[model samples]
Target: MLKTSTTNVVPEKKVEAKQRQGFRLNANDKYYASIFLGPSLLVLTLFVFYPMLKTLYISLFLTNTLGNTTVFTGLDNYVKLISSPDFLSSMSVTLLYVVAVTVLTVSVGLLLANLASQKLPGIGIFRTLYSVTMGVSVAVAAIFWLFIFNPSTGFFALMSGWLNLPVVNWLTSPTNAMWAVIITTVWMNLGFTFLILLGAIQSVPSTLYEAADVEGASSRYQFFKITIPMISPTLFFVSTITIIGAFKSFGLIDLITKGGPTNATNMLVYRIYKDAFYSGNYAKSSTEAIILTVIIAFFTLIQFKFLEKKVNY
Candidate 1:
């Protein structure tokens, strides 16, 4: 009886050992996965997440110019930003640019994408040429446009006979500067809009077009009833990206206009830069920065809440 009981216990002990070893292997695998994932996640948290949270952290305080100490004041900075005329003006200009850029980019992109979707001759070449703008950096594009639209020493000067108009200062003039910024932004940003829309157009089902053809539906009618509905998600995404970009626009403004002519073209980002570096008001700069963040957050939330649901249609 003693010998039989010992033999039975040996098998049970072996089973327990095997189960413990299997659990150890699983834990080791999980530990390795975490180790491999650590670098990228740490970088993202430090560079991206940390800075964003830091901005919110700084927005509640006043930095002493002489003492270099930060003083907390709750929402006082926000209140000051709201009442300031410069802030109001900058906000208005920023909004205008965002709206105008979104409209122009989305409309032109959809039009180009629809045209390019057809089996037209030389489309491959045209698409490549049109997408060249995407490769051009914003600073370079702005400089190129400045040269192209130059009144006295540019391409416009050489082709003076085409239109009977005065040679205007493109960058210095407040009215023309704003318009110039818009034009440059549209040209540079159109490629992205086109690329996104093209992808969306391709994702649309061929069966729908075939069905429309079988029913003898006109091309215009099919596009309106089918293509538009299918590609709305793409449009919304591109619009949101474009608007956010317009708000964060500083390279072109800095390179092209320098926020001159009584700060006519000085949008919010420009104002923030100026306040921080040029005007030597770090506290106000932080306040303006937070205002910008809030504006973008509000708009983005609105878009996700309302427009996101309509994407499937």
Candidate 2:
């Protein structure tokens, strides 16, 4: 009996030691994780979170040209913005711009991705060409499109001449200016969206396609039934980012339109910029910034709540 008890005691001691070692290892892992993540956390706190909170706090006050708070305005800025015709117009334009850009970008990207996914001769070249814009900087893209949108000496002008159509003002006309900006934005965003969708498309199991082929599914049928469902998650992800990006679009507008042609392309972001930097109304701009942030966050939440349900894995 004593010998048996000694054997059991030895095993118990070994088990306890192993557990203690595991606990120590886990604790070390957590310590190392915190050490590695500390810098990133600090950076985010300093830059992103801190700025966001500061912007929110600043939005409640009236500020001077130097961005120093001069008076406690409470919700006056918000009230003024809500009642302002320019602000309302900017909001409407922004919503329209966001929807148009997001839709067109995703649609064109999905189409390009599908075309690039085809197994054919010299497909790699086409894929590379399609995704090349991903490397193009916004400034470069804006410059490239600026030349193209030049009313008298642009691509559209040349095309109009050839087609015997009257020269359509690409950037000068209020109606056409918004479309021109939208086109430029769609072109700029297409590459990233295409690459993401292409990766998602290629990652779909070949065996599933084979099974669909065996079942005598038509190409169209298979595309809608198999390919779309398989890549729905990527589509959702792409759409969400595209919407957010479209809402935050400012550089292209600044470079190309400067919210021009009678404030036709005056998106909320550009409005915020104009208010803050150009007009030097920091409080109003901060209010606009907070509103824009809320709009983005709200749309993102809506997408996650409704659209995420449609995502497959």
Off by over 4 Å in 2: 1-38, 299-313
Q: Candidate 1: where are CA atoms >4 Å away?
A: 1-30, 157-162, 298-313
lDDT of 2 by residue, 1-313 (tens): 5345546567788677668878999999999999999999999999999999999989999887899988898998899999999899989998899899999999999999999998999999999999988988779999998888888888879888999999988888988999988998899899999999999999999999899999999988888998899998789889989999999999999998899989999999898889888999889899999998998898799787766576552
Best by lDDT: 2
Summing lDDT over every window of 10 consecutive residues in candidate 1, give the lowest-scoring window.
1-10
Give the CA lDDT, 0 to 100, for residue 90 in model 1: 77
Q: Distance from true position, residue 200, model 1, in Å?
A: 1.6
